[model samples]
Target: MNVLVTGATGTVGAHVVDGLRYAPDAAVTAASRDPVTARERLDCATVGFDFTDPTTYRDAFAEIDALLLVRPPALSRVRRDIIPALSAAVGAGVEFVVFLSVIGADRNPLVPHARIESWIADSGLETTFLRASFFMQNLSTTHREEIRDGRLAVPAGDGKTSFVDARDVADVAVRALREGITGAYDLTGPDALSYAEVCAVLSATLEREVEYTDPSLPRFLVSRYRLEGDLAKAGVMAAIYTTARLGLAARVTDDVRSLLGRPPTDFRAFVRDNRTVWT
Candidate 1:
């Protein structure tokens, strides 16, 4: 099977690329905005792909059997940018699609994932939706600086989040691509943990005290705005945390284990493996 993985260098996409390397029957191509850099980094077949650029779609989807659709976080306008790309993929004769969506996206029409899911269903292509929970890697990538400084600041209140490792999510995506699995699966870690509990895990693993500030929504918005300097991006992040605060992100499931034939990686194991980032 030939597969194209969008956002190839991103959190979960990068891991997808790595996992596909071992799949003997699957030929994987990494899609990036910069194919030259992606080729150099991933050392695999790379294609230049941009969601807003229709011209790149044909070449990116050419001769592809399945697609791993991942939305770049920067692009928010789904109607203008994403829908066209999905349409192009269909036109190009792509057979199956595995969309990396978020948990609670089906019920929450406010998030872009919901609209994308709806469009894919109507597009008549075979597809699977991996509605993943909050990623544990968020601490290592998005909030790395805060963790380095020994503070975990977010607007998630005291709500627990079922955090899945990106590697686990990627493993499932690879399986879906190779086996032609179709349906919606809610992928999550073994436990739901609040930021306070997360901090404790970090402290024990890293041998340093990590504190959860439990900042309010307004404060988080201002802080994110200052950090990213983009109000729209900040607003999107605030909404995710708000979902957690409302106790909507804590649902755990056996989907990961069922699909992978193994228990999902726990938060403490993730911290132990990636402890260097915080140090």
Candidate 2:
């Protein structure tokens, strides 16, 4: 089996590359925007590919049996970039596609994630949608500076979220890539924990008191740390925080267990494993 993984340098895509390396029968190809940095680190054959360019898709799709499509974060415009890849995959006779999508995307039109989900469903290709919740890696990277400063600042108000480990998401993606599963699986951690709970876990791991501070939405919206890139970007992040505040993302599921035959890793364990990031 030949598998092509897009966004190969990303957090989840990096793990996916590692997971695919163990499958001896599979020819793994890692596609990245910057091959010099991303390709050298990966064990598989690397190719130069960018989402915005249609010409890159045809060369990458050539003789590829299945694909793992991951959307770039903070990227508000995707249809123009992704549709060409989907069409190229069809023309290349690609068998399967595994998409890393956001949770509750179908119910939230405010988010562009739903639009991508719709595009995948209507593409006339066999696909497996891995709808992942917010990633715990966000704490280690995006919120790293805040954690180092001993405070977790956010606009999410008392909102509980089921954050999953990126490794687990990669495992599921590799399984779908190799086995060809055809359904949407909502991947999440074993428990739903509030932002405060996450801070507490970090405190325990770092052995320093960490606090969760609820900053005003208006203040953050206009702050320098604003993640808003465009209309879709701003609206999507707002919907995510809104969903968290409304307790929409608090549900825990056994989809990870069903797929991997083991329970999903909890948040505390993730913190303990990556304590150096917090310190």
Candidate 3:
């Protein structure tokens, strides 16, 4: 089966490539806008495919059997960038698609994932929707500096989240692509933890007294995210915090362990394995 994985250089997509490369029956193609640069970055075969460009969609989808579809966070124009590409791929007879959706997307109409999901259902293309939870990687990337400084600052209001590992999501995605599983599945870590609990875990792992601070909007926007005076970006950040605060992301599911037949990597292991990043 020829599998085309979009967003191939991203954290989850790259792991999908890594997992599928070992599948004897699956031929993996990493999709990117620039094949030359993509080829240099990815170990697998590369094709120049951009979500914003319909012209690039056909050639990349041609003769492709399966696809791991993910809407890049920055691409909010779902009807424009996503649907057209999906329509082209389906028209080209691509058999199945494994869509990387998010937790509570079905209920949250403001986000693009739900709209994309609705479009896919209406498209009648065989599909599997992986509604993955908050990524544990947020610590290592988006919220790392605070951890290093022994403080966890956010306006999440003590709501909990079941953060899944991106690698685990990728593993499930590869299985869906290869096995041709079609349905909506929730992939999450074993535990749902509040930011304070999260700090406790990190403190235990790092042997430091990390504290949690529910910072005000100005402090978080200007100091934490460093997007001062950028209302658009700040608004997006606020929406994300609202999602967490409303407890929309706190559900823990065994989908990863059920699919992989192995336990999902917990937050402690994640913090331990990526210890150097915090220090």
Number of the predicted model whose lDDT against the real structure is largest: 1
C-alpha-based local distance difference test score of model 1: 0.91
lDDT of 2 by residue, 20-89 (tens): 8878868888998777777678867888788777768777888999889887765656677567767778
Best-to-worst order by TM-score is 1, 2, 3
**lDDT (10s digit) by residue, model 3, range 165-229:** 99999999988888888899989999999988999998998998899888776667776445344
Model 3 residue pairs with clashes: none
Clashes of 3: 0
Candidate with more favorable, higher lDDT: 1 or 3: 1
Query: TM-score winner among the candidates?
Result: 1
Model 2 misplaced stretches (Cα beyond 4 Å): 224-235
Tell me the tens digit of each residue's lDDT in model 1 across 244-278. Answer: 88888999999999999999999999999999998
Clashing pairs in 1: none
**lDDT values for all models:** 0.91, 0.82, 0.86
Instruction: State TM-scores per candidate.
Output: 0.96, 0.93, 0.91
lDDT of 1 at 71: 90
Kindly report which residue pairs in candidate 2 clash with one another: none
Model 3 residue 35 CA deviation (Å) reads: 2.3
Give residue 34's error in model 3 in angstroms: 2.9
